[model samples]
Target: MKIQSASALFRVAGMAALLGLTVGCAPQTQLLSSSSVDRPITLGLSAADFEQAAAAATQSMLESGAVERNDGKKHIMVVSSVLNDTMQRIDTDQLVKKIRVELLRSGKVMVTTAIGLNGAEDQMNTAFSELSQSRKVDRSTLVKQKLAAPNMSLSGKILQRNNRVDGNKELVEYYFQMTLSDLQNGLAVWEGEEQISKLGSAKGTSW
Candidate 1:
């Protein structure tokens, strides 16, 4: 019986070792930084593409005389409708977020999270604003709330066009367009467009 038990233990150990060896032979996967990747794998849009578009648009907007203020006060801005007219299913945030971060870093425009075209970008603002109505909450802690309206409204659209370059290669052009409008006058203060074109195999759609 001891000999049989010893033999079973040896078999289990051997199986585990074999399993470990198989796992080790499998392909390795890892995370890659988007900034480090300069080449696109397909005609589809990538993080690099988004970064490029954001950089171009933000730089142009800043250079445009529209954002300049003699009052030395940062303009409060709200992100309005950013429509994705492309063929791919894309969250417009992929483009808008980078632009927002860059603009905030520039310090010329301050974005209000409490206001948006659909609703409050941050729902916490709504909840806090309603804290006075909660009977269970202490009234003394409630601060008088006043939300600032946006000085400028930001809106944009992403568009795509595809054409056959050859039997195997197709050219895809993507346009990232943006506009900043002064809320007071209802006119566009700045408009920018960044175009990225790529030629690759006409395989599947842009991921």
Candidate 2:
């Protein structure tokens, strides 16, 4: 009886240990202290600011006649690498896609998906290949009409800097820089940079 009792107690202890382990492994949400919660956070502008800046920058580049001057005829363009060097993680392609779409809508530039960082733009190449294969035209004649080469390539980088005045407040600055490179000459014919700064508490308890 004593041995059975000891075994039961051991089982209970093991179950309790398992329960404790499971609770420890569970996800936890931390409650911020009042001081941390009360810290000030301010943006120079709201989300609208980022969106507007991206749109405006893209528009300025397209309207600047840079594309027209390079190609003479409206030419195909491919957006190349964009490096993000900001404190906050952001998908740089969001800005790139916006610019690509805007350029397409402007009817001033055609973006060739056939050529991209990874071989070809998936959808464009797939469609183009299908059309070429299924077309009834003589293959030699089709080959003579060369696929349009990209006249310009767009690429750039984003840079970030941070400064802390005291233990509490911090300033973060970001710069978005982009360049339109003439593919023929391998030169950056146009370049632009936009800077944005924000001030906030260090702990991210606020904002």
| Residue 137 Cα positional deviation in candidate 1, in Å, after optimal superposition | 2.5
lDDT of 1: 0.89
User: Could you give me the TM-score of model 1 versus the true structure?
Assistant: 0.91
lDDT of 1 at 202: 75
Give the alpha carbon lDDT tens digit for every residue of 98-140 in model 1: 9999989998889999998778989999999889999999999
Extract clashing residue pairs from model 2: none
Candidate maximizing lDDT: 1
Clashing pairs in 1: none
Q: What is the C-alpha lDDT of each candidate?
A: 0.89, 0.73
Query: What TM-score should be assigned to candidate 2?
Result: 0.64
Please, what's the RMSD in Å of model 1?
1.9
